[model samples]
Target: MRRPPQELWETDVLTFRKMRNLLPKYVFKSLENTIKQRTKLDVSLAPIIATAMKDWAISKGASFYAHIFYPLTNITAEKHDGFLSVESDGSAITEFTGKALVQGEPDASSFANGGIRSTFEARGYTAWDVTSPAYVLETDNGVTLYIPTVFISWTGEALDKKMPLLRSNAAMSKAATRLLKLLGHSEVATVNSSCGAEQEYFLVDEHLAQMRPDILQTGRTLFGRPAAKGQQFDDHYFGAIPERVQILTQDIEERMYRLGILLKTRHNEVAPGQFEIAPFHEEANVASDHQQMIMTILKSTAKKHGFMCLLHEKPFSGINGSGKHVNWSVSNATQGNLLDPGDNPHQNLQFLLFCGAVIRGVHKYGRLLRAVVATAGNDHRLGANEAPPAIISVYLGKQLEDVFNQIKQGEVTSSAPAGVMSWDVPTLPEFPKDPGDRNRTSPFAFTGNRFEFRAVGSNQSVSGPLVALNTILTDSLTWVADKLEADLAKGIELDTAVYAVLRQIMDLHGNVIFGGDGYSEEWQTIAVKERGLLNLTTTADALPILKEQDIQELFETTGVLTASELKSRFHAYAEQYIEVIKMEADLVISMAKTMISPAASRHLSEVSATIMNLKQIGIELEQENAERVASLTNQMMDTVKNLGNALNEHNFTTIEEHMQYCAKTLRPMMDQVRKYADDIEGEVAHDLWPLPKYQEMLFIK
Candidate 1:
């Protein structure tokens, strides 16, 4: 009996709404208190809370629970524990202890800890994050209680993305609170960062996905000639949703809503078979948890619908790659939205200062920001059509740019008010929403109330970028607070102090602000040569920035990440970069040899046979096609052998050197192999080709 989506709504989740109904008011309050105060679980109240959570889970048909954590890799990690316990008397009972609810042990060495945890010392802890609510995850076999958790080493170093994200948020909150207080806000609250990530992904036939080793292993096509009619015509953007996709979207939304995810919109993306789903803004930690789940659900639901979801940045060539536009801002209970420039000019002074702080942070840590999103998959998208260039810059729209320009020149005496767009006639409606045109090209753009960090790769976990953004902002805001305090102690007014701080920030870091097309090569050159900005175009260049002494000190001072933790993360990221590129290179070799070569060779054989037969008849059909096919097949084979030889050399003294070789030497070699392979694919016969064509994958399904 398939239930309609409306009837199935939240039926499988132990949401907060369900928790409210099951627990006593005070019991719920205790849980909230733990989240708000960062207090340890009250031992006496733990049983009560656990019982309520268990009851809610059982109501959703859950007989087991899983402590789900996001590890170094951008994927969900979980350890399922059954609720039933067999007694000595052979009786069975279901129970959940508060201690069990709060923590669990998982093997640390299994994750990408960058040698943080040795195989012998395989102990790791998963501490429950109550702020991100627990939920009931439904599977075909059974439902399980899913509690969001943070992974850490036995020695107390952060081993997972969530730990630093939470720590960074706390640091930012403290810094933002102090700054707000200095700005005359007495009733300050826990200012937390918020995010709204727009996830873009492609859907292809499951059969096709299963057949392609490249897509299966790399989440992208290693070799595919462009479709005859690609997105060049621009017909797919915001087009009507396919029926199958619509049903899948409905299923995913239902699952998300059940888990208390706040989904806002869905639409066809620019590339055919590509689409996007976005959630309304939520607290950064909770939003990251939901984002992981969103990706999970997208893949799981797509499987159910006979489609495979491709989150790879560039799943196919000759088309716009995917990106997760992470819209970020900070807010608190007292200050609804710290980034919001209120209508009143007097109140907006604080907003401008915070905005100025962001510019300063980005300018200072642009390389670090780029490092977080550096992946083999994303490198294809960063400077691609749908993505921002490698150079980091802030895009304040025309009106906001004008306001900031005035501030940089020493005084922001006035701000450009939102303009009302009139319809030229009395009977039409008017609006005031469009502040100015948006710059999609800018990697970091202030889109109204929030800054959209658009450079984040689609397949990445938002935790990394958020960790950097929050920590950097903390550094900048703390600097702003210190400067203002010094000026205030010298008897300066609040507005005067803020303006002075902003002026200094702009004068120093204002070069980061650009209101032009980021795609322009001229801007790229000017940004690096004239503006004194860091242009780290590759993971090899960017990841080293994480290990910089200043970056380590920044994290240590903010208490977001210790030096050891920073070192571990850098090693992990470097290893990941090396591993990812290696896998793709290996697959390119394998696919080119097994699939592409065979197909091209077979086509050549047929062409040679036809030409020879024509020569026998004394009717010379030109041998040009046969000659071309043979030449391409031979060239491709040689490149594959070259790539194979390159892959064999692994002796390296340092992680940095190894990563640089992969980035500089191995990557270009892989691209060279792909170039010939893709060219061979074009020349080869369609019927003889082993893998599905791009036209088939993109347009057919």
Candidate 2:
């Protein structure tokens, strides 16, 4: 039966709602009540809720439950246990207790902790994070209880992502409240960090994705020729979403929305099969939890729709990569957005003060800000033409920058020029457009009311970057608040004191502000030599800065992260970088030796045979074809040997040594290997290639 296009889209949306509706109604209702209460979990209600959760899971045919937590690895961990026990009557029974609901113990020795945990001391605890609700994973046989929790070691050392994120939120809120109070907004309470993360990803057909060993193993195509019809035409950006992709997106969005995630936008991106989904802003902690859920659901939903979601920064070569653009801002229960510039921001003293605080934060801690987004996968994306450069800078637009300049020059009555808008009717009122234009190339850009951090990697847990952002902003805001309090106590007028601080901040750290192109070579030179900004280019270069005296003092004073916890995170990130590189190198060597090299050799043999037969029969074959095949075959052979040697020589004695090896030897060799393989792919016949080509995988329905 042929279905109408609109009906087809509606069907996809409906399918998603159905999947979400499969969950018990009471579960969602409980979440709603929980959100409304906005308090610590009631001890009395714990058991009742646990019983309800157990019963719901049992009804869904669940036999086991897992306390799922995000560890230092930045990925989720789960420890599953069946719900079976013997009753007094010698009958089988399933049971779950409040204690089990509240906490679980998992081994911690293997997890990275910067020497916090010894091999003999393997115990780790998972304490339920009541802020994030539980969900059920229905498998073919039975369901699994997925409890969101925070992991910690026996000695109370934080060993998970959630703890730091929660602490950072608290830090930001506390500091923000202090600043708000100074601005005479005493009614405002419970300041919160809000984030709207735009998740970008690529969708390839599951069958073709699985056929490529590199994609299957590395979450990207390690080597593939560029597709003839890439995103060069720019037709794919915000273009009509493909029907199959639309179905998958609809299904995912409905599921997410039902789970209380406010998904706001979905559209095609610049790369083929690359799409972005953005959610409405929410409290930073809730937003981070939802971001993780969105990624998991996107992957699962894509599978159902016969697609594979590639969240890697560079899923394909010669095309735009994916990124998680983290839009961040602060707000309060009463005052709304702290970052918002109302109709006339020039008169809005509070908004200008907070903006100055952000500018100071980004300038003072730009190195740490760069460190937040550093990752092995992201290393390939950053500084490329498609993404933000390595240098950290803020884009405040022309209006705001000029306003700050005017203030710094001691000018009074600084105001934006009134803009005009025409209405069709003569009696109708006219409106003005926004005062500033957007700079997509900027790493930290102030859009309407929030700063969009464009450098965050797609697969990263937004928690890490948001944590850094909130902590740094809190530190800067505290400084601003202290200065303002001292000035007011010294009998300086409030407006004069505010203006003094804003002017001082702008004059000192104003160099970080740039409204021009961030991707240009000229900007890079200006950012470093001209502005004297730190350009920490890689994870290795940036990770060590976390331990610097200034950063340590900032984290300690703000109480966002303890020194021990920060060190643990440093080790975790450094180790993760080396591990990712090793994995990629191993995959490259395996594919080159087992798949690409052999295929190239076979093609070479066939071409040589054809050439020999043509010569024997006195028939002149195309010399260009034979020469092309020979050149590619020789290049592939040399690259494979070099890649094998590089992989074999990698010293994995220590994490630091391994990371050094990867940076100096393994990565460069792998790139070389991929270069030759990609070249060969362009020359080799499609039938002779062992894996699916880029054109087929990118364009196939």
Candidate 3:
């Protein structure tokens, strides 16, 4: 029997449209205003709203409800409770109170708290985020109501990603609203940052993935020989999607649409067995939640289809890695897209102010931007020729760069025109062309209207980057607004003051903009020496920027994160980095000893037997093959021993020092072991190899 296809946007979601029908007019209006405007929820109406929500879920056959929250780690967590309650007569009755809907208590001791809370103090709360809608999630067992919430410690310190993101959005909106009001906009609605993340991942056969312990445990292969035919031919990019993968894509889209996620694009990515899925932009908080859902659904649905979705940045070495390019922008109901330069960009003061805010923010907080995206997985991808380099530079394109250069030169000039494209063949139609070409090498590039942050790892959550971007913009916009107000007090005209402020910004911070190829060594040298940009090449190098004085002040002033909260994040990330490397290092030793060495020994015995049989027949066989395999196998085991020793050394004085040791010492040793193991893999018999090869996992899929 075939399951009927689900209708788009009509499945399990309890959207605003559904609520409007379910609640009374006044109650629905108040809830809508609170959600859309980011205003405080009316506590008096909570019971009414809770009753409506409970009835809706009960009608959908939901017996339980769960509060879903995003913790410090890049994953989602949920605490479930049954809706069934006992009456005085021992009969059953369903009960969901306003207080229950508004708040939940979950233990915080086991999560990564960075010493924010003691083990004895195990209390944490999950508060309802009314901005994000609730939905009934259907499973094979039954259906349940999932409410999006924000998790925090008892003292109100943020213990999850959502709190920081919501706080950052609020700060950004306050700064943007103030700036807009100063620009003489009498009616300025609440401002908000938006995000659309392009997710890239690889799909491998489950059977093959199960054969490799590293992939099963670490989300990536710790050691593997490069495939004979890799993505060097560039034939797999944008190619036809496999039928099985296509079926999974459709299933994912249906699930996404039902959850009110606006998935827009799907296609083959740059590597074999890799693919990308993109969604239309949404408010930053909701977008972050939706992104998490997309990742979860990708993994779960792929498992159902007999595949394992690999979100690790470099799941397979020597091939293009995956990235989650976050397209970000700021806007409000009063102004559509602040970054969109109208047809005449020179005359658009509002657009210039907002765009200049982004430019100045990127320049002033480049280190913070880098810190937010740093991780163990990202370290393997950055500066690898597939993703953006570690240096944080903005690409404004030729036309926009020209405009900024003119501003820096203290002059007003005409905007650059976007031309038309024509060909000699009259049969084909002419098309309008963009004013400038795109630079994929740039970490933060303006794609016509919004900036695409290309350095975020595929496996990481988007909330960190979104939080950084919002907080930085909050600071920059505040600076701009202050400057504008000071100039206006000096009796300068609005247009003249705008240009003067932009010019000052260009002169002071315009060095961060680059239009050249970021992957080139020449640019790296120039960026460090001439441009004064910090080349933070690893997580250890970048994560320390979180402790900088200016960063701490920026978060504090913006009300995005307090000093303790910010410090906690730094410790959490540093510990996470150290943990990931240690796990991978241990796996490297185990695989080399328990898997690779045994395979090499088996193959060596087979080769030695062949040579003996030939010698017995009086036919001479060369000993080179046996010697090479034996040498590599021995070298691999020796390196594994060294790695184990390095892993044992924990003489670090601080978490930062420990992180650096892991990056500088343990990582290199693991690489050394992998080098020998991969070489042995190349020389050993294919049939005798214990782990599955890259070629079989990638191509066979």
lDDT of 2 by residue, 1-701 (tens): 53433433322121224323643565545644555434555555556567777876677567888888777665667899888889889999888888888889998998888778888999999988776666666556667777778889998878888888888877888788788888887676677889999999999999999898888888988888898999899998999999989888878866675556777899999988899999999888878877888888998899999999999999899999999999999987688899998877777898998899999999999999898888998988998878998889999887788888888888757667647878889999888767888888999999989999999999999999898898888988998999999999999999999999998998899999998888788887898999999777777677788879899988889887788888878887888898888788888878888888788778878888887898998987776865776676677678767767777774467666666777877788888888888888877777899998888988747
lDDT of each: 0.87, 0.82, 0.92
> Which regions of candidate 3 deviate over 4 angstroms?
1-6
After TM-score superposition, the amount by which residue 390's alpha carbon in candidate 2 deviates from its true location, in angstroms, is 1.3
Q: Whose TM-score is greatest here? A: 3
Error (Å) of candidate 1 at residue 448 is 0.8
- Clashes per prediction? 0, 0, 0
Query: Which clashing pairs does model 1 show?
Result: none
Q: Of 2 and 3, which scores higher on lDDT?
A: 3
Which pairs of residues have clashing backbones in candidate 2?
Answer: none
2 or 3, greater by TM-score: 3
What TM-score, computed on C-alpha atoms, does each candidate reach? 0.97, 0.91, 0.98
Q: Considering lDDT, where higher is better, how would the candidates rank from best to worst?
A: 3, 1, 2
Candidate maximizing lDDT: 3
